[model samples]
Target: MKESGRKQGAASPCAACKLLRRRCAQDCVFSPYFPADEPQKFANVHKVFGASNVNKMLQELPMHQRGDAVSSMVYEANARVRDPVYGCVGAISSLQQQIDALQTQLALAQAEVVHLRVRQTASLSNHGFGPGSPNSSGSPSSKLMGSQVKPIFDMDMVVDQASLGESMWSC
Candidate 1:
């Protein structure tokens, strides 16, 4: 009695045929488990089985099984490709949210700047020389002279100079 090359005793089949064990033809090597027509579906098979073994197994599958395998492979590959695109879309949406938040902050900052400028202008005018100053009612020269009132320190200086000469003579 010649023993077949197939490994025995492990009823657990490959991941792909595990769910549909009944659908898989008992042949084990190339049955429905190895769909060769779908090259991409079996793309990862080479990683598990050696390339030559996967090729030989796929080649032995029936034409209909090969076509079904190929279709399944394409669907799997498309899903893999879609995952990254979906992730990128999620990233873009988050970025847009951040941009919107920044824009709102910028708008608030601009409004605060305008409010500060208005307050500054109001304070300057109330102190009498900005655009709405009361000094506008007076003649320009009078307004200028009024704005330049003699410093109180100059009187102190004159008194100090007068006392200095007397103090020096006394000494």
Candidate 2:
């Protein structure tokens, strides 16, 4: 038993303990999440959040939550490493801009729908059929014979054309 214990110490330490220059206990908090083979994972986490803090967090959390916590830490660390300043905030801003653009497009589309309905109703009244006439399909109210009523503006195509990056916020 004593010989086995000595051999276990000789075995390679887990990434966390190796990076921190300490022996990895058999029950180390990092051992399950970070293996010895993936040193870079530990290095990234260590750089963003010190080893001691990470260890403490893992220890405090329940076993089921530790995996998700580790994954989140790695993702946040990568984003911070890439941006340094803005980090996740940059991503959120970009998404919000897209949402706003899409909403504006939706409003414009709704207005166009109303305009077509009015034009259809006028044409139908001329032909002795009212707006709610059972003779017509709801879908074709916007179409005048074979002519399709095109949208006044295409929201997605326009948003993609414009670069809503950091420079957009200046104005």
Candidate 3:
């Protein structure tokens, strides 16, 4: 007997239809987003929001927006499952808090950098590198001794983080 046109290696029903124990129609709503291999994804969505609601929402949307809507629903459903109280909002809030803390640290570090610069300028002024031709004590002998005093911070080692960030923007 000749074989029927039906391919022997046919694809199985999608997660939704399989979980619901129903035959997957050719135009099944969940087929595109939820494949047969990954039943957990559909289960997650189903657990959070029933399949009926998802189907209705998908049917109401325009074809162009459906894919994005499905992806968003899946992501939101996943987040909701993970975080019961706040879901995606909790994740966003945590990220924002981290950003705020980092910004505060950056401000402190920048202030310290400015302070170091001022102190360095003052130190240089104490030596021959400043105005009024060297030390405030008023002795040329102090100028000879000033050369022995080491700089607070090596100028070559000091990096201006703000300028570096601007350069990264240009790149």
Best by lDDT: 3
Residue 61 CA error for candidate 3 (Å)?
Answer: 1.8
Please provide, for model 3 over 1-171, each residue's C-alpha lDDT reduced to its tens digit, 9 standing for 90 to 100: 533222335458789988988877777888888888989888988988899999999899988898998888889889999998898899989998887777667666766776787677577667666646534443333344475665445545555768545543341
lDDT: worst 10-residue window of model 3:
1-10
Worst 10 residues of 2 by lDDT: 153-162
Minimal lDDT window, size 10, model 1: 151-160
> What are the runs in model 3 whose C-alpha is more than 4 Å off?
1-9, 131-171
lDDT of 3 at 138: 31
Instruction: Kindly report which residue pairs in candidate 1 clash with one another.
Output: 38-70, 41-73
| Better-scoring candidate (TM-score), 2 or 3 | 3
lDDT of 2: 0.71
Residue-pair clashes per candidate = 2, 0, 0
lDDT accuracy of residue 137 in candidate 1:
55
Model 3 misses residue 29 by how many Å? 1.4
The C-alpha stretches of model 2 lying farther than 4 A from their native spots are 1-12, 131-171
Model 2 Cα lDDT, one tens digit per residue, 100-132: 787667666655655655665576667755546
Residue pairs with colliding backbones in model 3 are none
How far residue 145's Cα lies from its native spot in candidate 3, in Å, is: 17
